[model samples]
Target: MDVTYPSSLALALFSITLVLALFVRSLRSKKTKGQLPPGPKGWPIIGNLFQMVMNRPTHEWFHRVMADMQTEIACFRFARVHVVVVTSSEIAREVLREKDEALANRAEAYSIDLISHGYHGISFSAYGEGWKLSKKVMVTKLMSPTTLNNTLVSRTMEADNIVTYIFNLCQSGSMKKPINVRDATLTYSHAVMMRMMFGQRHFDEPAEDGGLGPKEKEHMDAIYRALDCLFGFSVADYLPFLRGWNIEGEEEEVRGAVDIINKCNDPMIRERMHLWREKGGKEKEEDWLDIVITLKDDQGMPLLTFEEIRAFCKDVNVATIDNTMNNVEWTIAEMLNHPDILKKALDELDTIVGKDRLVQESDLCKLNYIKACSRETFRLHPPNAFLPPHGAREDTTLAGYFIPKGSQILVSRPGLGRNRKMWSEPDAYKPERHLDDYSRDSMGVSMLEPDMRFVIFSTGRRGCPGTKIGATMIIMLLARLLQGFDWSLPPGASQVELVANNSNLFMAKPLLASAKPRLAPGLYPKIQV
Candidate 1:
């Protein structure tokens, strides 16, 4: 039988034993040779766990503590684990770049382990040969420039579809009605990923208004739920013995979301695998699924196992959807609040792409101001408060501080973007700040920030491999929306509310804005199929 919660007597006994064990270990442990970063003092056994618990959103709490200490880097201990939080680009580089080899591993967590199929996926896997092989396959076979270029037609089609959808929404009522920017952006991002992955947009019938169908909505909802649980801080992660107890209900939520995701994805993957193995592989590769399925090793056998393929599919789905959607949503909201910025972006698009045609991926190079707006959004409002924590593979010194083996190094997203030392008036949103001394040919605006000023796509050993495609998707989405239509706030609202959600960095409320077609009637492409 499974016990959801322990009996009072049993719980009391366990707590006593845990405290005593920790006390004894603290007394017996030897002092380290070097200094650790400064942080708040804690109780005997629990360390800073209670302080963290009292703080509702842990990321905010961490930032406040670091600010109070007036330190760029700080450390906190949660049941013997040393978590080093970095708010400085210098320290971030020191950990992720200078000592990359020594800190290449990923910290083990319960939700990540469950979702990744015991670390079978690339993103959260431990640093080892398995990770290397998976990254090589992902980079070379799926996300390389050559492959992405080959798949351009699919992305182009979705770009056209977004314009068509928005045009339809604008025309629905005699007068313009407020459209849900969040819904439209999510649908577009989802459609692009689906077309590239499965060669089709919908599992069943398509929604008439270019929104998600029932099946698509269910699948996307599950994906977001899984992301929330994966990034959330779990008590069981700190206390390994309480993993299955479901004390916080995180385990159950993760299991349910994973079940939904598998139900939607596994059948399709299995059917395709059967088509390749039982029947014969397709004569022509149609989509990414075919490309991954047809990959062969030196001995003329399947390169990856079924589990690995499924895990990869899931990873791509999770990674592709969130950042692009959130960035576009945030950018649009910001522009509406600052109409001057919106006008500047519109002027740039009109000057480069012209009003006679829709913005194409090829036009992205010349649109420096548009690219700056995107960069500004990334710097001000990242999707997550922190990048996924990088774990240390061995004991090392970082910025003259001793980092014990198994320590987790967290890079703050807002901390770097708003670091007073790196950016002047860091809290303000100014796209021109990125345009200073910017050259379209030499620098050529893209989502990557190699200098570690602000992270769009990270760098180093465990950096994102899909930067080329990712940059294309972001720029295209924003460009099309700006080029094809005119956007404004709803009737009564004076300005867009830029408050971020407590759990994550997404807008607390979905953005509702009025849109009117800004181009010739013939410009918007009709939806095919």
Candidate 2:
């Protein structure tokens, strides 16, 4: 019994509403046109995706373009995505501090889902109560100063083992055989982390042939494959329509690697749980694994399920081992390339930590020069060239630019570290620049502060919680290595290549060097706990 309207009338009304909506949108766009940061004009639809990918690598290209345009902040478009790259310390501070609340969470990524176990870990979890709880547990149980102090014995012992292992190699032929610096550091880092986290060592003994056994290699390779997925840009990441196709097969590869890692790690976790339950949960906590399995929340419920525990532990393993190893290697490489600097570091080490005993954790605070060297290395080669992608949680403004909801934010660590305005002789490696004031700030030592001038550990709410432990690890290892051995490029290797590989985030080329013992022969004995 209703009155019928013609189809044409309904169509006319719909067309009028669409026209009005478009009119309002154009007006809003016009108001903000001049406010956006200067950037290259992109083609319609695809935007600058093709142009950026066709040019130099994404990080380098952005640096070059920002330099050419003389802009601290630049805006660009990639398909439907809006990207904002900040290259100045001032703007970085604004984004990371002033607008930190709106930009703390990471942009959506498939890898976060696959690798972080549905964003359960601290690094990739969404910014909310859950992330807060998880982070609280990590800070209190694992990264607290008291806990680090308790583990000092284990770390120092590991450092001693490394020196002993190197000495063992030298007994056969000395500097005649070049040692793989990367392999040595990686082994040391992994072993120490295993002991601290699980209360056990991964490797029982050196293989009969004195190389990593098959099982050991399998476990290490699985971790490497899983972490490698974090680097570079992927088409599936930017475009949602192509995710199902798995065009590059990244998803499948990640899944396989995760399976392998879980296979290797699950049994150890199960054993720990079994022991805890057998004791009616009365066992005193000794390590990170014990803490995660035993800690409870406000409601008297366990803070994490078994799966969540595994995922969080895995995050700690990947971040702690990978970053510490890479940072140490880069610092050494810098020293090798600059012999004068190497001599300076050695002078500092020799003066501060003598050959009477190995460098201990207590010695790190007094070694300011060594700390400077680590800072310079970070400025030059931050483990992550680009900080993890930050997104605008709501419509906001950054440096007078109109950043709509869902705009991606990229803070270029290498770019800002090398910025000419912020530093004098930014391209050159000079540790003395950080020596102006020897006082400690938020990051412990002068060199380790969380200033926007050099964001090695980033800043604000999402800053790396492991900074304190990480700084201690790098300084301690570097001090010990330089104190115990003199390093140089192997024969026929004219120079150490500093060029990075595009395949991964870390140094592309392996660091191979000849090591000659610099300590007294009598000091080479194994350290007794």
Candidate 3:
């Protein structure tokens, strides 16, 4: 005779077994560890999982809980894992700098795993030889000073194109049309990254209005979709058994976004791989794809697998666009609201780069006030709520609290910037605060703040490798816009409203501003496809 259990009975049995296992583990943890960080006591088995799931935007919830508790560090458990959130720079330094080696690993999550193609890329890959190899390639080949210098033409071309695009917008209507700061900035960023990655601006024909083309629009939409889902609070991430159940529909969304991204990227990658391996093409590297595809191991074999190349390409696309675009948009909006700041930035541009020419990458070194404006935006309006959580590889002690192995260390981006302890009137947009008493020639401004005052590009073993490129892109984008046109609040709008999106830190509304060409007509380069 065969004995079978009903579905409900099986679920009930599984739940009971899970709770008992957790109870046993908790008792063992209590015996071994000193004490966890301060936080609200969660239910026995679930351990704040419900609260996390119910929270619409989990970062706000975490911030509120920590605020109410009056603590900079807080721990909340989800199932068997401990999630520690850090708001203090001292503790942030402790996690990212002092104990960097132990906390270099990234947390394992369903969404990131899917987007990264099973940890093939550096950003989401587990800490090990594979991650080391990927980073080495990224730093040495793709983002090296040599490569950046070589690719200067591509970046410069896109910068000129944006000026031309905006000039056309200014000239198109009965009066000058209001510029969509967000769209123009996004296009400029997208075009630059595409030129560096694929050696082309548009996947298909270029947009008639110097905006995103049909294929490019679809591709960017998918990329933003993927980003929206990435690192989101998906219930299935903590409860592995519920993964395929499609609870909250996150899995399906990620899969669909990844599919769209792969569809756009994989074909180009495969075609290039064939050219290198089969046809012996590309004697000189022209783009980042060539650098990645042609890299070889000591044995003279391709260093990265096909999946690794694809994953790296996808990682570059996602990482480069959003933060740079958002920061520029926010900076412009803030400047429009505070005309004094706007005038100061324009004056600096006029002094450094006269109206006869556009701002170049070389000018970035001396543009201290402009760089400070960008830094201020980074501090006040970070694109994300938290840096990707760094997972602890072994049990460790941090700030006198017992941290278990595999505990996720989440550093709050907004928290560090807005901490009253760190800044005077932290909530206000004060670019002057970042300005220092250093000469222009001797003092070069950078997006990185090594003291952990606020993270533009994170620092440490697993930190971002693209800081130079990121800073150049950000400053150049801002400089060109400021030098090329006179920006003002659109007619009938008294001031730019600085409200943030409920779900994310993006401006609640895309900034609309009026622009008039401030430079000679010949200064704006003719649009080139």
The candidate that achieves the highest TM-score relative to the unseen native structure: 1
Q: Residue by residue across 31-85, what tens digits does model 3's lDDT show?
A: 4377889987887666887677565578899999999999999999987778999
Q: What Cα-based lDDT does every candidate model obtain?
A: 0.84, 0.74, 0.85
The candidate that wins on lDDT is 3
> Worst lDDT window (10 residues) for model 1?
1-10
Tens-place lDDT per residue, model 1, 101-132, is 89899878788887888888688899999899
Better of 1 and 3 by lDDT: 3
Q: How many clashing residue pairs are found in candidate 1? A: 0
The residue ranges of model 3 lying beyond 4 angstroms of the native Cα positions read 1-32, 437-441
lDDT of model 2, residue 410: 90
The residue-by-residue lDDT of candidate 2 on 1-529, one tens digit each, is 0112345433543454356445445553323433666788875554676565465346667778888998888887765677889988888888888998888777666666776787887888878987888888888878998888888878877788778777777777555798778787776777677778877655445454333456556667767776766554544566565555544556666677778777777888888887775556544778888888887778977778886888787887677776777778888888888889899888877787777888888788878778888888888778766777787887788888888777788988877888888898998889878776565543435545556887667677777888878777777777877888879889997778886655444678778889888888888766332
| Alpha-carbon TM-score of each model against the true structure | 0.95, 0.88, 0.94
lDDT-wise, the better of 2 and 3 is: 3
Per-residue lDDT, model 2, residue 274, is 79
